[model samples]
Target chain A: MNTNLYDYAYELEKAMRSSDEFKHLQEMYKSVTNDSEASQMFDEFRNVQMQLQQKQMQGYDITEDEVMRAQEIANRAQENEKVTMLMEAEQRMSMTITELNKIIMKPLDDLYGSMA
Target chain B: MNTNLYDYAYELEKAMRSSDEFKHLQEMYKSVTNDSEASQMFDEFRNVQMQLQQKQMQGYDITEDEVMRAQEIANRAQENEKVTMLMEAEQRMSMTITELNKIIMKPLDDLYGSMA
Candidate 1:
């Protein structure tokens, strides 16, 4: 197989890493990890969030109580400066990935639509 | 910023491209594109699919008629051998991307869960 596409993928990855979003995300991650309490709280928040997503993906409805509980955890986690910064950084990084995925998937999208 | 993470991202991209799923997808893509009729049908299908996705993303309710129309187009497109192969190939490619995205986003996912 021709290696040009693979080479391009590597280049794309390098570009993504150099992006401000990824850099900021890495910085925020470091800051958050530096604080033991904040890091623990973030972990809790992440666990709750993951459970909710898995439930939703499995076609299970999340109850109002569960939503409230998750929101409560999130609110508390966001109170930490590092955690908040991490959240913002995470958003930026996720947006970057979404954009990259769009571009990367275009040829497949053109051939088969967004069905995938 | 430490360049290690970026280097790893590049490696990940290279690995994705070298994956069997990606290889088959590229082959199918080439085959479909070589056939003019199949390629044109695929384009039309893609256009309709994009429109539908945009509507869904915008929170617009798609009418039953629209769904049926899109399904009709899809059915005809699938009748073409190259188109069918392309669709399968696209699915495989998309699956590889999803897997890669999961791996690439692990740190972010660990810090923030699957919220993104």
Candidate 2:
């Protein structure tokens, strides 16, 4: 079995899931629900989640129901553009990580397959 | 009628959900499901998504099923650490957006509540 990819993925997944950045984001998102400000903040988080999910789904098979849900979620975070902008910025950073991972992996696959 | 908070939240949520960064992440995530390289990439995505969801869920009411789901998803992307890393990176980016939203909203809440 090609445990190479499987093992590599597992370790990487562990690192990502455990990273401080990931943990922090989790904390921040939860923070949104803690107080009045927090609830407002959560509204912002929900906005970004909805926006990213919607746009990324552009030519994909996302259902109408999903789109509606996204809209409903977005409506909850509408009052502050500043908060919305901040949320957008963070989402971009997360997307960059995805790009970075792919960039690193292509060569390794070539290297491993050659050895195999 | 303290929709000041509710309205504000709705708009911010809309913005976050609609932002370019959010859209981009969705696109990148879906890209992983398109081909072999993409699948390897997807496993990485699963890792980050799992990590973010799990970590963000800290002190929250996440269930065992969700944790198991996250781990299972992480395993799929184990073939490529690079992909896993990228996925993690993207998730962090998404999470930062949440933080930024909170920062921007707190003051607004204070100002609005005072007005009321």
Candidate 3:
């Protein structure tokens, strides 16, 4: 077929962004970033998240101390009203991305069978 | 709107999988894995790739020695006929994914503007 996979993927993304879910997410994100305190809290929370994700990806075990520290920062970040709303929006987007990833990874699954 | 973005995404995935690009990729992958020598070489190349990516993501700079070592491994991996075909397939897929990501991140781009 002459169809380009990238073209289809682009259309899919356009459809996703046009949804209410994406609009709400963008609004919530704007609200969060507009507040300086909330923005700082978000930055700190994201730094911890990146560090933890990096450690996990490298196949390293996360220390209990690091986990506790991350939890503390996360709890603080979640305590803010705007941050909480932003997180709800983020959660929905995260699920959508997960679904998209499953779709994208089908070829590998087909190739590796149960191993994938 | 009552439309679920997920449904559209799934339809798009169906379209992608049916494209010649995906078919050729699958065929190339099958040919590569079917050859034991090529499979071993591919595995080695992927391991090095993983290590270098992990290092880079952790904010570590690649030393001259590490770059040379990776290049050597990649050269050997590219020399195999089936592996070369698989790499071509993977490159096309990579470009497709990059386009998809750009679309998916539009909300963030709108929020962060130039910083994004």
* All candidates: DockQ: 0.10, 0.02, 0.30
Candidate 2 lDDT, tens digit per residue, A13-61? 4444444444544454444434466466555556557665665544245
Give the TM-score of chain A in candidate 2.
0.47
lDDT for each candidate structure:
0.72, 0.49, 0.78
**Number of the top-ranking candidate, with DockQ as the measure:** 3
Candidate 1 docking classification: incorrect
TM-score of 1: 0.58
Clashing pairs in 3: none
Largest lDDT belongs to which candidate? 3
Fnat values, one per model, are 0.00, 0.00, 0.44
| TM per prediction | 0.58, 0.30, 0.70
Candidate 2 per-residue lDDT, tens place, B1-116, comes to 22232333334444444455445544554454445675655745555576766555442455688767767766666556545644664665446444543443333344334423
Residue B84 accuracy (lDDT) in model 1: 93
- Candidate 2 predicts chain B with a TM-score of 0.46
Q: Model 3, range A1-116, lDDT digits (tens) per residue?
A: 33566666667767776878777888887787789999889888888999999887665778999999999999999899888898898898777778777876676577657322
